[model samples]
Target: MGETTQHFVLLLLCLSGLVHSSAAFVFWTAVVDISYYNNITNDTEENFCECGVYGQNARVETTSGIVVLPRDDPKGCHPDTVYNWTSSPWIALVKRGSCNFSEKIIAAVEQGASGVVVYNADGTGNSTSHMSHPEAAGVVAIMIGNIQGMEIVKLVNNGTDVYMTIDVGSPHGPWITSYWLYFLSLAFFIVTTASIAYFVFISANRLYNLRMHKRSERKLRSEAKKAIGRLQVRNLKRDDEITNSEAHMCAVCIEAYKVGDVVTVLTCDHIFHKACIEPWLLERRTCPMCKCDILKALGVEEESKDSITTTLPQDATVITVAGGDSLFEVPLTEPVRSDPERQQHRYDNRAFEGDTEGRE
Candidate 1:
């Protein structure tokens, strides 16, 4: 589950990078202005002019008079033609042709025209195009809808003067520079910073847990060493020295303790081979039979870096009951002497009241 969450975070970061670095472009638009007086209406009204920059240098303030060289000839070019431009600036209106856009613009340049407007072919309606005439520089050029061009043409044929204006329109560019780009940058920064912080948090948490585990192990080992040192380790005595009944079989290894065999006595008074219980104490820190912490039984506990001592009453009594033996109490008035290196201990107040005289 942790690994899945981590992968999800990584995937989000990748997506953010892709979105932040993506590219965007803007298209050019033409602004055409046209106006003429209508004899029937007896009023001069401006015509709706929607133009697109078709070629280079399309920045004419105004152009008037007739539109000439209007059709593409056999060579797919609108050849030069003379126009009576002494009254007003000449605006050349041409049709879409098979020849390159530059060829048509060059033809108009030869005819002394001030600007050029290229309308669409017969089948295409008012669809405008962006035409770049790099070959004919400083010559204002633009494209208009076929329907619009035809309207102006009819007006001109009627012998009415039509005036028009042209210039470069609004600009467009990369998406990153747009308004929404700011929002994207903000979100990207927030998510990226959060991811970095989360990564650092995870690293610090893991390190802390590791250090705590190592400290716990060291603490347990320290207690184990103390308990092992205090414990009695010696060779098993002969039958005459120590009674055979006290040398019971080890519950851990399930083996009897033979004379001369090396062994250790636990705080519970239970005995086992020294080798067997040391590893068990280090791992489990408990007696095999009673399942009690030997460290606790030995009165040696690791509370913290500093030792905590608890005082108990000095005068006490030990009571015990054995099978086939009567119950009795033994008084204990001795204040245990504290060893310099070991923690103060309270001697156990339990003793076995066995029938010592009935043994023989």
Candidate 2:
């Protein structure tokens, strides 16, 4: 797959994992309803509230039983704690402290309790948190506020029987109740849009560059054809110097010239068979022997003079005197005269003199 496709697939996998983890954090709220006989009014009184959260591993179902507190250790943290109630359907009420929620829930489950209610710690007026009790599964477990638990504990202590019903309420998760969900969604949208835009830009730039390169190549080939037509062509005769000698040969075909053969001469004065050199010049646009560009030589194409400068070796140019005697050498660009009394300047001064006369 392409790199973009791989990145999109990876992004989808991360989104799927995030959704699954968010679902795991989701938990159900509990609706706790308690009813008891009020001795002052001689009537049955009922109080209900959806202020409870179920444990992570607990069964999310309805269960009703008589509320029962531990006779010893109200937190129900002890392994040997017992309940005085002798009933088949009894809910254990324990304070939140001293141990994990699993220990308290397991203690009640072992004692024939159908459900467990754990209250929040002291000073936490009516706030309850979701409990995690993986070791105590299958049983209905919920956590209520501290003030609510104290009211039921006081009723049971006053010899009043309290019947409690626990029912599953609404589900709550981080995505539903947290502000970070909006921030994450916005960030993901911005990243996805920027990636798509960048990919499109890169593809368009590559296509544009390729088209420009091909257009330039076709234009250069057309100009080379024009330059070839302007070169010198000749028909060899029997008495020609090339046909009479065996030393000269066509560079393209590597064959000696014969009488009545047609040939073309390039700007560098290198001659080759017309048929052989035409195709070679069309492709390379340069002489095979001297590497001379026909387009620049015939004025078919203009090139920068500064960019076409010749480079020479570090050694100076050697000069030969009239009698074949050696004399001082001088650099080509900057010539220096060794003797001020010389008869005439040995180096050619026509180029410099012409520039001076033109200015005058």
Candidate 3:
């Protein structure tokens, strides 16, 4: 039975060691990262400080034990009583008296002790009091039993050699925890990289699309301008052609008037193709040139008040005249021979001469 118990205890000790080793690995390997001003910059690096190790200036606490040291000397106290309740680096022995644990510790701090170990002066059970450097200075304090206090006090009084030890808990740092943290940090890095890549791609795509749209709009505007210019050029050409046709010849669809056609003269003397002017006069009763009122020109005194109608020609005649083609014919539509001894008088006198001869 004794051997079995020893084996079980050894196994428990081994398990405890493994657990501590694992904890140490995890703490030492864990990566700490800091990110500041994320919008402006992303700078990250590994932290090198071991998480499981304590620094020399670290704050710590002591187990249950009364401390004894010089209380009034500033040189012996690590931190002066002004800043911390007690001076550090020496055990303090405080007797339980008229004050509570808080008061006792305050007195001990005022006396410049490194650590405070308060003990009950009258009672048997000494409630362990944990001391804190409420001032944020690193002073370790603990409480101990009356017997422990008396032992330390006896050494202080007798001037005998005494040594004190403090046990502080250490962090566990192991390899597995280090690797785990390292991988986690790596994963975070990959994710961050992918996110940045995606953002860049989307921005580039948007910029490209914007450029393309602008280019397309520019092209469309250019084409429209060209079309408008062409249309204006075509209109100008058409106007020039119409002016030339009116100057050199009549309109292509209508010929000029022949000699026999009835003619209405305009005040401006700008004659048009008769077929064209006839339709125009029927619609507007005015000469095509100078906008002269044709009815007034033909002797209507008040052209606007009168309903003028066209009359048949009086003494109108047709005289055959030569034109371009072989004996191409033309006619005079008005009485060109208006003299009394002309053809009309000759025809009238012949009949009279014949009547005179018959009477003789």
**lDDT tens digits, residues 274-320, model 1?**
88888878866766544456887788866642332336466444433
Candidate 3 Cα outliers beyond 4 Å, as residue runs? 1-176, 232-360
Worst 10 residues of 3 by lDDT: 27-36
**lDDT value for model 1:** 0.59
**What TM-score does candidate 2 reach?**
0.45
- Ten-residue region with minimum lDDT total, candidate 2: 319-328
Candidate 3 TM-score to native: 0.26
Q: Residue 53 of model 3: what lDDT? A: 19
| Residue 243 displacement in candidate 2 (angstroms) | 96
Q: Model 3's lDDT to the true fold?
A: 0.39
Worst 10 residues of 1 by lDDT: 348-357
Name the candidate, 1 or 2, with the larger TM-score value.
Answer: 2
Per-residue accuracy of model 3 over 192-276 as CA lDDT, tens digit each: 7999999999999989877766665455344433332222111112222222321222221233333333332233233444555
lDDT of 2 by residue, 10-105 (tens): 345446786565667777789999999999999999999999999989998899999999998999998778988997799999999999999999
